[model samples]
Target: MSALAPAVPRRTPLDSFAGTWHLTRFMLRRDRVRLTVWTVSLLALYAYFVTALSALYPAAEDRQGRAALMEQPASIFLGGPNYGLDDYTIGAMFANEMTLWMIGLLGVMNMFEVVRNTRAEEESGRAEMVRSGAVGRHAAVAASLLTVVFANVVFALLGSALLITAGGLAVADTFALSTAIAVTGLVFAAVALVTSQLTTHGRGATGLGLAVLGFAVLVRGIGDLQAEPGEHGTWLSWLSPIAWAQQMRAYVDLRWWPLALSVVAILVLLALGAFLASKRDFDGALLTGGSGRAEAPSMLSNPLAMSWRQQRIALFWWFLGTFVMFGATGTYLGEGVEDMVDDIAGSNPEAAKMFGDDPLTGFLAIMILYAALAAAGYAIATTLRAKNEEADGRLDITLAKPVSRGRWFAAHLAVVAFGAFVLTMISGALALWAGALVNGEVELATFLKGGAAFLPAVAVFMALTAALYAWVPKITPVVWALFAFTAITGMFGPLFDLPDAVAGISPIWWVGRYPQEPIEPSHMIGLSVVAAVLLVAAFVGFRRRDITS
Candidate 1:
């Protein structure tokens, strides 16, 4: 052992995170716009929610009445376990009604942010290049988590300040609620990290993360429905990080223990993710994908077929999710529509307006609106797949073949249009069928017409996304911003007392509330014409633009 083996230093655990700060800085720089948008949106939504709640229920009696309505299974499923309902204050209402939704939104945002930086970077070969530098094996994951945590911290601080100053909520309760929201988001970010280690594809990771979220929602909803007011939900609720956030009881009791659960979970998940990441080869996953066919099927011969093949799995997930959610809502509605309507109307007239005089039809119309929004989301995602393919250089390879750019682009749009229509129809039919199963009477045709009424709006959104993709691929994400604006306006416009001119800017607002009011043929014809123009513009722009890659 010649002087030889002067022992080389063994790597310590901290060595794995050696370049974490550098990568974190890089990630922040890369996602500055995205992170800023999420932050600002959350803050604005929180402000709006606080302001709306204060204005809508100015008195203690009003708050208590609103709390009574929240006892409904549908309300509990959408909101949270009925905490502080007996003495419901504005702060308590915010904690009970809005906490879960905010955390859920944050969960989605965190999932995408983590998956984008981790698995997506790996898929794009960027991680490999980064790791070739002085970066440690775990630096990328650490960086992603740090960046997300940083964003959450900023949100929590700003949110706490906003609640205190704007809503005049209790300082302690506001801090507790804001902290819980931030930690809950971190929990999901950790979940996404684990998922990213489980699959090679970014879509697979994102899907897995979302599936976990869906499960959490389902479990938490069911658990909350099983429990009475002022009580902790069933054990199933305890299993969800979302429930953990709510269990903090920010306004009622303000317990800090629930947050400990989330912290422990984050640690465990982060550890597991790191272990998996280290054990696998770069660009590999612990759960390796199975081998595919040695030969391409005849279906792969066309651009349209290829597009369907790429999108069918995601479409299936969407359909399944929509079915489960609406089916559950319908089943709950079966309890007593009249009573439910009376409770809702008695509590909040603004919300009651969404359901017209014919309560059942009006309720179904609102569901149809939700279904249409879901379809629009699916359409946007499907349309953006073209942009993704182009950015990844796959579209160039496909175009290098005999296929024309216009044909290839058109195939994606066709899939988007058809998929959106089917999703909307499925949501309406399933909701009606499920409701009829329990309630004993629902006309399928009425719901179908309600679904059909939104087809034009769906088409417009799809066309708009396609046009953006064709003309300015860099700004394709603006479509999502538009989608968000439309959703907020459609859902809260009535409550906010927004003017018709303001609300009319949303394409969904253009569609008549079906079953409640007859869908106007003129609205349909005009929307179709607008969609046609946008599609024409998209086709023309695609023909002229350079392939991004």
Candidate 2:
């Protein structure tokens, strides 16, 4: 026994990616609409920006502006040290400015969820019925990966085309950037594939995928920031598929080999994931069951308490995230850095004109947006807890008690509404303390001001989520759709020259864009009123409606 080694499984040639194409057509049909939209919307977002940027900033001047900004440490940490900003266009600016933040984040979430939820769900028991008939195990996962890969490639081509049309880049540069971004996604998609095989639960799989995402971001951030200004973050960028795409620098340097690295990473990850997937038994969880406790814990007193008990881990993590993201660590640079960035922005005559004498407001505006968005995130997730409970059949028994439906919905709402407030405060407090600590301001008033100002916009999300949970349960996805819409609109809408009407839909537009200190009380009150109306409608509908599940 002391000398025994673990057993290894034998694999046959048949196990190596056979019969995957059989389900390709079915997968394409099922995901065609979704992929089309996902690819189109992302492309449109970049195209719109590229067009607007082409008009707003001439290529040569844009490059000069980027070069001036690279000298600032704050700028480097936040937006990546500029890629030797020469021959830059609006499209290049859009890519350089956002490559690390928005594009990277959206890419990771979209690809990871597609792999874990669509393909891994099949691997786990959800696909068994379909597999029992005409489907093969390899076919489903292969089809899904194909769909995801195709979607990414489409996005790449669309982005490249838009950049070429708007920015008038050399054809080679446009394709290089687009291909690099797509390759980056492929690498992460492979990472998700490997993660799904190792984890039995979907949540566990998602966690692994996110872990990989976090590593990519961290590696990219460190590489980009620590590198010298105008140096392209070189070898460090090679460590991350994202950094690889970013270093392609599109219209700037247009490096190619980094992308080859991304492709290699993807192939290796896919090979490893396939080998592991072949070894595991279907529907087999990673960890086996544990014996039940001899008796119930004292914490199982009431439904409210039980719900809290079950959700404590989530709450803790949310709180920690709120704390960690207070202004974001990278954005909080030393005074020398902040001063340097301000000088750079000041050096650009256009930015100087845009700032209108006070540029710090730009930073504050971003902070408010980030905090409000985080609060909105908390509100939506908390409200959706009721829907989840109902779906799980817990609500059926809970409603069977002396409890009324309204009371049940109200209890959950109360938890969410209060939790929303708590989350907001936590976010504000974190930002306030972080700012004060770094800058020696020592102002709770600053924190409270930021928290109070964000309320109206954030409150809207809580109300809408509650309304969605109560009345139109069929459209539950709206909670997230609206949440994401708000966030994306606020961030990209301004950059891309979207209609003021559409940008106005973001509560951010109405909240005085805080810490800039406009303090438009009337606008804040108006936003709150809108939120109140939605909440009232939800309450009324829930009071009258019957439970679906």
Candidate 3:
């Protein structure tokens, strides 16, 4: 008689998705406010940019002239693959101005969304508690991915609906363009989930994911530059998720293969992330470095120095990235931009606005703001580190030492300001070096001087954020909102036709257009004074407030 073979029970998809519904609901409830803000902000910005650009180039002839300018190296360096420019419509114009960057914005949104729900929960010990119940190992990950994917889908539908109202655009084209964007978001969200499984800390996961996003965008830009004249596709573009959407040529040919590639990539990344998550223990990382020295070094005695020590790794990475970005922008935007601008400027005077009246001057002006924006991000992240530590209970331990509340708070703010200065200097130097190399007639000193003109604005953001953290610790996340408000006002204020005084509220606006325009010494002095006042307020408020748990 043959022994009866034991049958292994098969698990359905529901088994893997166990507890995902409740988790998804919880995540949606938790993120509803953030989602609303992101959606509203993006929609508003899109409407403004689309409306402004459409008004600027309303006629087909104007659109064609604008499209010709886009073929220039300056345009290629900034915007990827000017599709449908031959018979360009208002919709195509909107896509040309907004698509690549919108993809980047959505990528960032998806990354933070995934990291917050997955690694952040795990790092804070909430994942363990949730998983101890009926939650499957992959439930949280599933819920997070679901929430972000749903958000992406909703945003895409809403954006496409807005695009339809632009007139002269085919409905199919708008749908395709929005689909491409949604797919790009999905791929990066998957990248974040994979990164979350690899790092024990949420910040590490966010950093790694952002690094990948930045590199992908760089590759896409290079590929766009290298694409042969009259060619629509490049092999280099195929390697980047950012370029896949552009490759779809949504408003042009509506190619489907590249989008299929994105979908496949998303599936593979999700599966790999789930596998990694299943193999690791909760709160454990697949990759880790050695622990710090048991005994504190003599140099660690100072609170400011300790803040630097703690933030050094993140600052180093950010500094390196800023250096690369500025250097590349300077090299690409230095010489050839003038010839290209001149060629198109005769046909469309509006080209001057895009390039800021003069090619080299405009490039430098834009690069200055770009560098300041990068520094602002560093400042905000560093400023919020103190609040994050306090939430983790590490602030109490440090305060239990010989440190006073005011001194401890002041040290963090000082470290952020100093770090922002160092990062700004690095970006400025690298930009000057590259610009000098490309524009052989330009002096390095002049370039450096022009780049340094924007640093005071960066400092103002740091001080303002520090003040908010000190007085309203619970609303520290609002710093990002503040940064967004500043960026939109400064960058798009002219396009949006805001009142001069309203635009002047942004510190970057006060910096003046450098190299093209002289530095406003009064503006610089005023910004410094503003920073000082904010710091004094922060010190006072921090001293009086109770430490947040």
Q: In TM-score terms, which candidate is top?
A: 1
Q: Rank the candidate models, highest lDDT first.
A: 1, 3, 2
Tens-place lDDT per residue, model 2, 181-250, is 6777777777777777766655556566766776676666667767764476757755776776776666
For candidate 1, which ten residues in a row score worst on lDDT? 331-340
> Where is model 2 poorest over a 10-residue stretch in terms of lDDT?
328-337
TM-score against native, each model: 0.92, 0.81, 0.89
What are the per-residue Cα lDDT tens digits for candidate 3 across 1-549?
Answer: 999999988978678779999999999999999888887777777776777666667667777766866765546755688877779777767777677778888888999999999999989998889988988878899999999988988988888777777544678878888888888988999999999988889989998998888888778888888888777648887789888887777666777787888999999998899888788887998987789799889878889888888888788777776776676556645455566545544455554565566655765666667777888988987888888898899999999989899888877877788778877766655554665476455557766675578778887888888888889877877778778877876565555667877777788888877777788799889998998898888888888788865
Considering only N, C-alpha and C atoms within 3 Å, which residue pairs clash in candidate 3? none
Provide the clashing-pair count of each candidate structure. 0, 1, 0
Give the per-residue Cα lDDT of candidate 3 at 397.
91
- How many clashes does the backbone of model 2 have? 1
Which of the numbered candidates is closest to the native, going by highest lDDT? 1
Task: Indicate the TM-score of model 3.
Answer: 0.89
The C-alpha local distance difference test score for the whole of candidate 1 amounts to: 0.84
Candidate 3 displacement at residue 539 in angstroms: 0.9
Pairs clashing within candidate 2: 20-139
